[model samples]
Target: MNRTQFLRLCALGAALAVGGPAALAQTYPSKPIRLVVPWPAGGGADAVGRAVAEALRVQLGQSVVVDNIAGAGGNIGTQQFIRQPADGYTLLLATSSTNSANPYLYKRTGFDPVKDFTPVASLAVIPSVMIVAAGAPYKSPADIVQAAKATPGKLSYGSGGVGNSAHLAGELFKSIAGIDVIHVPYKGSSPALTDVMGGQLDYMLDTGAYGQLKGGKVRAVAVASATRHPLLPGVPTFEELGIKGMQMNAWYGLAAPAGTPAAIVERLNGAVQAAFQAGDLGKRLTDVGAELRPGTAASFAAFWNAELQRYAGLVKLTGATLD
Candidate 1:
């Protein structure tokens, strides 16, 4: 009603206009977010990504949508994320194929897993199960080694892709066993498992995506880890199967484009950690043959670096080329 009161009101309005948006942005996730899964729907990556997205949606109080943009061994969807705004609203579901192995696999990957993406937190690690067709002569990993020894270049195995984690796992198996098994590269694990099931291929050492044992199409002979998974309790580990230094597993993590605000990254990480705390999320992961693993951004960075180093060594050892 007075001039002074009007001036004070104007000043208060200016301050609110400047500071209101800043406070709201600090809250983050004011709306639904998009999570890109770099694999086709119905695949392990998609399944896991959706599960995590659902959990994050509930934890963050914002809808998390999963978009499958599969291609080029997961680089297509991943590249899309690199080009997206680094504001935590857009996320990429990271897998071993895209993050750790793909960089070394390609002559030039569009995005650097370590530098281009900021890891929120690791979701889980799924152990690879070495499965053979039911009718295959190799009843165990030793049997496969014996076959490889007897027929070096003749004995062959299939993998999802040339430089995929499964292919590298098979190569590691060969290196440790002192055997030479030809790798038959397929587009994805589904097809590789298809051929292996139809007896078109001898065996496949892949991440546990096929669910072969339950279908009775293939027999899981060994797991590519130090200890056998509870889901594959009957199957022997590589070491127990007479192969040493051949442990391998695939992991999943949540990441955003680099340069995302630190607060936003922390908020996303907190949501992921909250999802991990919720019991059903762990059970869901376990049902999908993954063990829940949650860690801070620093821990994820260290893990990513270690993985990169390990895969690089394997790439050199195998002389495997993707280009």
Candidate 2:
């Protein structure tokens, strides 16, 4: 062919290449979408993932299924999710532990939280409350701090496991309160909370303690947030109690494998934002103690990056390590 014909053919090829991703993004969710929760079925992450999946199913007119892949402090599921195709079909219901804390906690997490995933949208932030048994002697956060100070290493706190958010929060609290509280790691929160109620432990931090507090099983001494949680309005914040550097929030967000089409990521983010704006998902999450945080992909990425740095510093300061 002549030079003019060759140039025209090259231009056509370029147009097809440029339009291919946009075309694919427009028809995204033509099949079912997998929402992977890197935790057990009954945990906070699983609940959030299921709720978001259902809302997305309704909003996107496609089936969004939640797949629980639990192990290795959420590293196993996260690794598995990151290995999937970057087609926007498989999504990870990422948490602070998986995306922020795990890398610093474990020596070999096998995935880079910042680089291995594409941020879709931030779903919510769940702040932990420092809880003690309802009948315990500690009536407030100050009481706990004073007791720990009076009897260093006598007051023990329970957590889901080493290097988990609860553990980190407890460490931060100890550091800020200038007390010596022993850390007791459990396989999961239920057992830890159970021990706390049984008086086997002095205190514990949890995001899902509202029901327990209402049922008179546990009492919240303080919330590890800047402000009081709506569910536990009577509970004071650590900062309010004059304890600085103890504010921590466990957040959840949606992410796809790295290199996913930006158009697809934006579409998913829009769906999540729409779901939150519709009020049902927001109410459901809030009822479970999650603070709604709907935002764009870019915003979520910035937030995620900031969280990584924050958790890294916390981990280093706390000297928390899983391996």
Candidate 3:
């Protein structure tokens, strides 16, 4: 071949060998990255999402912005999220409610939990607490159970919305404890928690309420975990209260849309690991009743898949559904 032809062939060969634009691109997150939180602002998941965005900002040297696309028990936001470009610029601040539990609870979740997203990192897990207004008659887990059994549907609990973690937790509590408490769904947890504190609702089970617990407005009846949380040292676990098969912990993780380059996914996972290792992200999340659960991309994927299966059974047991 001639000299010009030889150079052109060489360039073509290099381009072909390097594969697509995702493989050729060296700079990732060239612009501000969007972290989609399917829950409304001021909720527990939003807080976690904001924290992660800040961490990513420092680690990735790009502004990681939190976009609250809340509604429909996370289905609306997830639907919108899956439509974003899979270029690693747009990501998801995933939660158990959105990723695992909602599919089982809702008729159509808008996106397939496994096929529509790529797992980046497993960030943390927040244990749910069974909470009651401080001035309410019930003081302990047994007291709440007795009251529910006695009054049946008279006593009620509130949750942020149907198919939310709080709702799922309440369902599990009712099923395992054998109570007939009414479940009142609200627009968000803050309002639901407000009703709980005001005595409008008998109780609420969620990872939120840490702030209220400190102010003594709401009292924790029992943690849903098998062991007591360090943040809630005085609180007793349901297992401690002799209520077995009741463990509800909402998990948080990062994910990109499906078909995002694996290299980009790996890089994002590394940033997450680095963020968890450095910074007060761990402490900040822990302050909100979250325990750090950092892991690799593969590990996070496995955990995500397992959680999907577990929540499927849990949702089935609760008989909670939403559309």
Candidate 4:
């Protein structure tokens, strides 16, 4: 071959060499994938994570395992996932607590929520319900608001922990409704709701933890969303009561450590999105008071960032700080 022909052939070979691995990475999950659930077993996040993993196993033709790494308000497991090689083999179950709220709540977090992770896709969003104990004096939302206004800090709301979604939801209610209610933090939502039922806590903001309401333990006052939830048909949304812009939905998404290959990220996102639309996963999520929210990586990044800013402002407005 002539010199020019040889030079062109060499260029073509180099292009193929660079593009080959990119194409291979696109066919990711050639083996089992590890999905980390940062919460303890049997809660909403754990249940949802296992369902998604099972659906993904079918989609990817490989075993998808859910490893529960609970503690430190989900930061422990999340930080461990970030320590993994960003190769899509390892993923973290991202939640409102893990992604947006806890970073500001803790004095020092091991990983930068926005910086250390790349969004895969949002899995689902769990709506918080305004619930009061069955025997509480406040039979209506108006009654609770009026009582709060009248007593200021005397009325209280219990939450899972400091800076949890439930905690933020309570603060949001106080800000828009112009009430002063004391926020009591508990170790978890179960205990928080426990006290609410026992009359120790006046009310609480909680997610649909099942049995909490189905067993006639508490009365749902309102849903903290734009529309009323089907599970609690009788409950009204804050928006319907003329409380506009009072939207707070705790969400869960999927994320891989930063520096993961773009092709791998796309593959994982596709698998998750497909699983969400598969057989009973979406229905199950909805049944548990969560809506399936599927979106691309860029979309999730934008969503998460906006939530961070919004919550930061709300935290400031509530004058809530943890140290």
Question: How do all models score by TM-score?
Answer: 0.88, 0.89, 0.92, 0.84
TM-score of 4: 0.84
User: Which of the predicted structures, 1 or 3, would earn the higher TM-score when compared with the native?
Assistant: 3
Which regions of candidate 4 deviate over 4 angstroms?
1-27, 149-154
Worst 10 residues of 4 by lDDT: 21-30
lDDT at residue 115 of model 2 (Cα atoms): 85
> How would you encode candidate 2's per-residue C-alpha lDDT over 123-157 as one tens digit per residue?
99999999999899998888988899889889899
RMSD of each: 5.0, 5.8, 4.7, 6.7
Descending-lDDT candidate ranking: 3, 2, 1, 4
Error of 1 at 249 (Å): 0.7
Output the better candidate (1/2) by TM-score: 2
Q: lDDT of all predictions, in order shown? A: 0.81, 0.85, 0.87, 0.80
Top-scoring candidate (TM-score)? 3
Query: Over the stretch 216-301, how does candidate 4's per-residue lDDT look in tens digits?
Result: 88888778887788788888887887777677777888888999877788887887778776756687777678877888989998
How many residue pairs of model 3 clash at the backbone?
0
What is the lDDT, from 0 to 100, of the residue 92 in candidate 4? 88
Residue 39, model 4: Cα distance from true site in angstroms: 2.3
Between which residue pairs do clashes occur in model 1? Answer: none
For candidate 1, the lDDT comes to 0.81
